[model samples]
Target: MLSTSMRPLTAHLCLALAGGAFTCGARAQQDPDGTAVLDSVVVRSTKQERTLLQTAASIDLVDGQAVERQGLQSLADVAQQLPNVYFTDFTGSTPTLSLRGLGFSDDESDSLSTSVLIDGVPVYGNALGTLFDLDRIEVLRGPQSTLYGQNSMGGLVSLRTRDPGLQWGGSAQFDYGSGNRRRASAAFDMPLGERTGLRLSLGSEDADGHVDNRALGRSDTAGWSSRFARLKLLHTDGAGGEWRLGLHHARREGGNDFFVSTAQAHAHESAASDAGRSDTDYTLLTGEYQRALRGGQRLAITLGATEAHWNYWMPLSQYGGPSGFDSRTRQFSAEARLSSASAPVGGLDWMAGAYASRMDKSAPYLFEVPGYMRSETTARVRGATAAVFGELGWRLAERWRLAGALRLEQDRRRMDWASDQSGYFDSDGDGVPDTPYTSADRIDGLRVRDSEWLPRLTLEWTPAAEQFAWLTLARGYKASGFNLYAYTPSSAATPYAPEYGNHVEAGWRMRGAGNRWDLGATVFHTRLRDQQVVVIGAGGASLVSNAGRSHSEGVELNAALRPTAGLELRGCAGWVRAQYDDYVKGGEDFAGRQFPNTPRHSFGLALNWKPADGWETGVSVRRVGSSALYPDSTVTNAAYTLVDAHVSFRAGRWTLGLYGKNLGDAKYLVRALDARTVVAGAPRTLGVRASVDF
Candidate 1:
C-alpha cells in the first residue's frame, strides 16, 4: 500500500501550485500566429463537428505533422503529452490507458478502462497499428459513456486517417535509428473514376532489443518486428451523399519484454534464458455513409467488424518454468444517427442515435513448473450490448447556451470455461498447504446482465467573441464481466458488478491576439461508486472485486503562443489528488490511499520554430511524477523526466528529418512487482528519416 505520510507533502505541493496559477492567470499568453494558430482547430471526435473554442469537454488534437516531428511510434508516446493521462508501460503493440486518475480495474490484469475509435468505428483490445498516413488524433479526457457507452468511463480516443483526394499523388519514406532500428512506409492515392477514389498505405519496422538478457549473455531477447497495411475507398454520388469503405490489417511479433531483476542502475537486464516470443494479429473492416438534408440536418451510418489474435510464451527464469497462451477475439458493431446543426423544431442543435455490438473471446493456455506440476485450461466469454442515446443544445438566453445528453444501455455476458489439474492445499494448516490437491473437472456456467443510464448537462456563457466558460455535470459507466484467468474454483465463475462515476467540471477557453494565442484551464472532480478492483490471488491468478467508493479531484492548464511569426510555443500541466474513500480486501481496509499506478503530477513543454527557406525544428520535454502499482503487489515508481529534439527540411512535399529522444536515458521503472522484479525504460535513441511526394 502507498504511504499516507506522503499526503502532507503532496498537499503542500498543490498549495504552492495554486498560488503560481493565480499569478499566471492575470496575463494570457500569445497565441500562435499565421498557420500555427490553435483556436481554429476543429475536431469530430464527439460525433459532433465543433471548433475547439466551442466545445466544453477536455480534448487535445495531435496532427500528423506533430507526430512525425516527435517520432511518436506508439499510443503510449502520444498519451504522455496529454493532461491527466498516462499509459502503463512501453510494452510494445498493446497500450493500457488511465485518464483523470481513474486507474481502477477488475477484469484482465492489463485491460483498458477506456474505448478507442478509428474513423467512428469502435475498436477493442490491443491497439497495435502503425500511425502512418494518419491525419489526426483527438483525445477526450472525460467520461464519454453518453455517446460511446461502456468501456469508456475513463475517456475516449479518436483517430482519423488521410482520405483519398480528388487528385492523384503518392509518397514514401524510410528511417534508420539507434539499436539497428529500421522503418519504411509508403502511400498512394488516385481517382478510380468520375466519382470514386482509392488510397493504399503500408508500413513496416524492425529493431533489435534494448534490454540485455544476462542469463543468455544476449541483447537480442526483446527484438521486435511490425507490419501494417490499409486500403480505403471513397465515393460521392453528387446527390448530397458520401460513402467510405476501408480494410486494415496489422501484425506484430516480438520477444517477451515484461521484466527481470537487474543490477545496473540505468540499464535494463533480463534473466530469462529461453527468450520467449509474443505475436499479435489484427484485422478490421469499416463502412460509413452520410447524407445531407435540406435544413442543415444529416444522416450518418457506420458498420464495422474486427478480429484480434494474441499468442505468447513466457519463460520466467526466476520461476524456473514456462507459460504460454493462445487467445482470439471477434467483434461486430453498427451505429446510425440523425443529427442537425439547425433542427426544424425550435431550431436547436441535436443528435439521436442507436448503437449495437457483439463480441466473443476465447483462450487456451498451459502453465508448467520445471519438474513439479502443470495446469492446462480453456476459457470462453461472449458478450453483447445495445444502447440508445441523444444530445441537444439550445440557446437559453443572450450569450448563454445549455446542452444535455443521455444514454441508456443494456449489456449481457455468458461465461463457459473448464480446467484440468491443480496444486497443493493447506490441509495440515502448518503455515502452508501441506496436502496435495488435484482436479480434472468443469464448473457450472454463468450468465449475467447489467443496465445503466448515463446523462450529462452543460451550461455555457460566451461573454465575448472568441472566449467562453462552461460548467458540466456527467456520469460514466462500465459493464460487468467474469474473470477468465483462473484455473481454480475461487472467483472465476462469479460475475463482477458494473462500475459508475459522477463527474463535475468547470473550465474556460480564450483566444486573443487575432487568434494567435490560445489558453485554457479546467478543474474537475469525480465520485466513483462500486469501483471494480482487481487482485492477484494465489497461483498468480487474477480475481475481480468491488471497492465501496472513491473520489478524485484535479486541475489542468494548457497554453499555446506564437509571440512572433514562425515561432510557436506550447505547454500543459496537470495535478491530481486521487484516493479511495472506502476500500476493503481480505478484511484489510485501505481507505484514503491513492490508487496504484496513477500519477499525481504530469507536465509537458514544447517549442516549434519555422524559419524561412523551409527549415523547421522543435524541442519537447516531459515530467511524470511517482505512483504505486499493483496495490500492495508492487513498489512505487519515482518521478522521471524525458527530452526529445528534432530538425527537418521541407520543400514542395519532400522532407528530410533528424530526431533524438530520451537524451539523458533517464533511469526509471516502466513497471514493477510489489516485490523484486522490475522493468526499466528504454535508453536514448537517435534516428534520421527522409520522404518525398510524387
Candidate 2:
C-alpha cells in the first residue's frame, strides 16, 4: 500500500504563477493561458486548446473529477454517455465500441476499430478491456488518422494517468457491492532524491456474476479478479528539461461469458457446461525526454515497449458446445517522434512522428464432428507502417485561428493460414473427405496507399467579454485495410479489401457569462467506401467481405450548464441515419437498406451537485432510439432508457459513496438480430465504496 502525500504537479504550477505576480482580473477568467486557453468545459474538436466557441471538430472530453464523481465502471460507461457512440460487451471487461454506426465488423478476439491507449501507449487486444490506474479518458470522435494510425478510421480513446512529482502522498479506496463484489485500489508518490521522484499505483478487483444460466444449473456468468501496478520515476534538470521512465504490470483471470449454441438458443440457456474462463497478462515500459531547443522552440521524444498474452476458453468443455473456441495472441509496437511547438510564425504549432508495429495471432476451436474429425486453424498476420504527420495552427488574429493536418502513410499486410480437418461430411458440396480435411498453409498479400490531407478551419468572433460563437469545417479519414483476427482455413482463400471513410462536418460552440453554460453542436455527412462486414459460412465458419458504398449523416448537440453555484448539468443528444446505397447480403442485393446497429436518436443527461456543506450527489438518464441490425434492414433493436444515481459524503480525509447502476432495472438487449440471438444487458445493481487520502 502506498501513502497519500504525493505533491501534485499542478501545485507547483499554481505556485509559480502566483510568484510571477501577473495580475489577471476578468482576463484571467477568459484567456488565462496567453498561448490559448481551452475552456475547462469543452475538450474536443480543436488542437489549439481553445474554448468550444473556437473549435472545428466534434469532441467529448471526460475529466478526472467527472470520472470520480460518476464512479464509471469502464470505458464502456464513458462511450455510452457520449453522443453518437455505442458499444456492446458480452462481459464487463471485453467490449466493442462503435462510432456513428461503424465498428461491428471485426473479430471478437483482436484489436478494435476504436483504438484505445493508456498514456500514449497503445493497449492491444484484451488488455484494453480492463481499467486499473486510469485518471482521465478522452474520446476523440471522427477520423483521427492524421494524428493516430491504424484503427483511427473510427476514433481513438486516450486514457491518461496521474503524473508523479517530488512529494509523499497516496490514496486508498475500497468497495463492496451486490453479487459478493469486492475491490481495492491504492496509489503513492515519493521523492527519491533531489530532482528525482517515484510513484506507484495498484488496484485489485473481483466480483461474482450478475446473470444466471438456468439450464446450466448455475450462473454461467463471470467472477473475475485482477491486479495492476505501475511504477514511475522522473528526473528534471535545472534548464527546463525533463526525463521519465515507467514500468507497468497487470494480470487478470476470470470466468468469461459464454454463449448459447444454435441448438440451445430456443431454451435461452447457454451451452457452457461450466462458466467459461479467460486469462490475460500485460507488461509495458516507457521512457520520455523533453527539452527546450532555442528561441521559444520545444522538443519532446518518447519511446515505449509493450507485450501482452491473452487466453479465452468458451464453454470450456466438449459437451458444453461443439463450437467452443480458444484463442491466443501477442503483439509488439514502437514509435519515434520529433516535433516543435509554438514556432515564431504567429500562433503556429506543429508535431510529427513515425511509427511501426507487428502482431501474431492463432485460434483453434472444436468441430461438431467427433473423434474422426477434429479441426484447428491458425492465422498469422505481419505488418509495418510509417507516417509523417503534423498539425499547424495559425492565429489569424486576436479573434481568429486556422488549423490543418495531413498524413501520408503506407500499410502492408500479409496473412498465412493453417487448418486441420478429419474426415467429415462435405457440407459445402466440395466432395473429398470434407470431414478429414488435410491441413494446409497458404498466404495472401495486400497493401494500401493511405495518403490523406485532413484540414480543420475555425472562425471565432467574440462579441462579448464572457460569450463567443464559432464555426468550423473539418475532414477526417480511416485507414484502409488490415486483418483484425486470425482464422484457420482448410486453406488460404481470397484476401479481403480495406475499408475507409471521410467526414465533412460543420459546427458551432458557445459559452455563457461567468463560465456558467456551454453548448456545442455539429452537423455532418460521411461517406464510407469498401465497408467491411462479416458473413456466416457453412458449418459455423465466418468470412469477411466489403460492402460497396454507404453513407451516414447526422446531427449532435452537447451542453454543460451550471445554473447554480456548486451544481452542474450536462447533456448530449444525437440523431443519425446510416444506409447502404449498394449492399449485397446472403446472396441478395439489398441496395437501399439501412446499415446495422445504427440508432436514429440517442440522448443522455447528468445532474451533479456539490453542496456548500459536506455532501455531493449525482443522477443521470440515457435514452437510445431503435435502428436496423443489418444492411438489409431485416432486424432491429427497440428503443430503451437507462437511469443511474449516486451520492457521496466527505469528512476529514475520508469519503463514502452509495450508488446504484441501472436504477430503473430496465430490461433491454445490448446486442441482437433476427439471424443472431441477443446478448442481454445487465440488470439493476447497487454498490458502496469508501476512500481516504492523506
Candidate 3:
C-alpha cells in the first residue's frame, strides 16, 4: 500500500508541475495580430454525437494528429496521456487493461473487464493490430454497461478509423530507430464513382528487441514482426442513406517473452534453456448501414465478424522443457439502433438498441518436461449474449437536464474439456517416484448462465455557456466463465460467478473564452461485489474464483492551456485508493489489501511548440506511483517516471522528424512472477521518421 503521508505530497507535486506549465504559458508574449483557439473535440462513444464538454461522462480523447506527431505506436503509448488508465503488456495472447483500478488481470482470452471497440464493434482477442490509420481514440472512464453491455464493467476504449474520402490522395511514411527497429505504412483514398469511395491502408513493423539470451546465443530474445492491411468501401445514396463495408487482416510472428533470473548479472539478460515463440493471425469483416428517418429520427445497423488464431510455446521452469498453447476463436455480432436527432423534439431526446453475439473458441494446452513428465488438455468453449438497451434524456428546465438508461443482458456459455497425463508419482510419499501412473479425465457439458440489469442515471446543469457540471449513478457487470486451462475435472467443472459494481461520480468541465484554456475535474467511487480473482488451486494450478468485496475511489484532473500563439500545454493527474473490503483465501485474511497491478498515483504533462510555419516540437513526461504486483504477496513495483520528446519539420508535401523515448534509460519491471524471474521494460530508444503526401 502507498504511505498515507506520501499521498498528499504526491498530489501537491502533481499540482505544482501543472501550475508550472500554466505559468510558463501565461508568461509567454502573445502575438498582437494572432490568437490561438483550442479546437472542439467530438465523441461518438455514447452512440450519439456530442462535444467532450457536453457529454456527462469522464472521458479522454487522443487526436489522430497527436498520435502521428508523438509516434504513439501501441495502446500502451496512448495510455500515458490519460488519467487513471493503465495497460500491462505481457508475453501472452492478450494484454491486461485497467481503468480507475478495475480490470481483468488473468490470462483468460475470453473475458474482459474493460472492453475495446473498433468503430462501435467489440473486438475479441488481440486489439493491438488495429491501432493504425485511426481518426481518433476515446477513453470512457467508469461503467458503460447501459450502452456497451457485458465485459464493459470498467470502461470502454473506442478506436475510430479514418473514413474514405471523396478526393483522391495518398500518404507514405517510414521510420528507423535504435535496436534496428523499422516501420513503414501507407494509405490511399480514391473516389470510385460520384457517390462511392474506397480507402486502403497497409503497415508493417519489426525490431530486434533489447533483451539478450545467453543460453540461446541470441540478442533479440523478445524481437517481433507484424503486418496489417485494411480496406473500406463506402457509398451514399443521396437520399439520407449510406452504406459501408470494411475488411482488416493482420499477422504477427516472433519471440514474445524475455524472462531473466534476478541472479543474472544484467537486467536485460536471460538464461532460459528453451526459446519461446508466438504466432498470431487475425481477420475482421464489418458492414454498416444508416438512414435518416422522418420526425427527427434515424436508424442504423451494424454487422461484424472476426476470427483470431494464436499459437505459442513458452518455458515454464528454469531448467525444464517448454509448454505450448494453441487457441482459435471466431465471433459474429449484429446490432441495430434508432436514435432521436441531435435537436430535441418535444423537450426530449432518446435512443433504443438491440445487440446479439455468438463466439466459439478451441484451445489446446500441452505441458512437457523433456524426459520426466508430459500432459495434454483439449478444451472447447461456446458463448452467446443478447441485450436490449434504451436511454432517454429530458430537459427539466432551460438550464437543467436529466437522463436515464437501462440495459437487460443475458449470457450463456458451454465448455468441454479433457486431459491426459503420464508421469512418475511418489505414491509412498517418500520424496521419490515409486510408481509410474497414466491417467485420463474428462469433463463434458459444463455450462453457466448469467443475466444482469444495468442502469445509469445522470443530472446535468449548464450553469453557463461553455461550462457544465454533472452527477451520475451507474451499475456495471461482468459475465461468468469457466477456467479454460483446468487440468482436473474438479477445476474444470467449477464456474466463477458474475461480478457487479455500483458507481457514483460528480464532475465539472469549463472552457475559457475563445477556447484559450480548458479544465475538467471528476471524483468517483465504486463498490464491487463478487470480484473475480485468480488464485492458486490444489497442485499449484491456477483457477478463477469469485473472491470478495472491494471498492475504488479516485479523483482525476485534466487541463489544457494555449496561453500564447504557437505554444500549448496539457496536463493530467489522478489519485486512486483501491482495496479489498472482505477477502480471505486459504485460511488467510486479505481484507484492506490494495489491489494488485493498480497504481496509487499517475501524472502526465505535455507541451507542443510550433515556432515557425514548417517546424514543430513537443515533449511529454509521465509518472506512475508504486503498487503491489500480486494479491497474496507484499512485493511491490517502485514508482517510475519517463520522458519523451520529438521534433519535426515539414517542407511542402514532405516531412522529417526525430524522436526519443525513455531518454533516462530507466530500468523497471513490466511483469514479474517472483523474485527470481521478471520481465524488464524497454531501454532508451531514438528514431527518425520521414513521410510524403501525394
Best by lDDT: 3
lDDT for model 2 = 0.57
Candidate 1, residues 576-623, lDDT tens digits: the string is 888789887766677988877677887777777777667877777778
RMSD of each: 5.4, 9.0, 5.4
lDDT string for model 3 (1-694, tens) is: 0111100000001111221112211112235534444335566534465676677888766666556655566666666556777666555223446777776453453556887777667775354632578777778888886554334888888777788989999999898888787889999999999889999999998877777777779877677788999998899997868998989888877775565654451367777665577777888888888888887687888888888887776655443755767788898889888888653423888888889999898978877665566778888999999999988888778888788888899999999999998888778888877688788998888888988888889998898988889999999888887777767677778877888999999999887986688788999999999887766644546666776899999998877787877777878788988888998876767688777777789887878788888887777787878776542245466788777788889999999998887787766665555555555666787899999999
Candidate 3: clashing pairs of residues: none
How many clashing residue pairs appear in each of the predictions shown?
A: 11, 18, 0
Candidate 1 positional error at 643, Å: 1.0
Q: Count residue pairs with overlapping backbones in model 1.
A: 11
| CA lDDT, every model vs. true structure | 0.69, 0.57, 0.72
**lDDT (Cα, 0-100) at 669 in candidate 3:** 62
Task: Count clashing residue pairs in model 3.
Answer: 0
Candidate 1, TM-score vs. the true structure? 0.91
Candidate 2, 148-196: lDDT as tens digits? 4343766777666666768888889888877677888888989888888
What's model 2's TM-score? 0.84
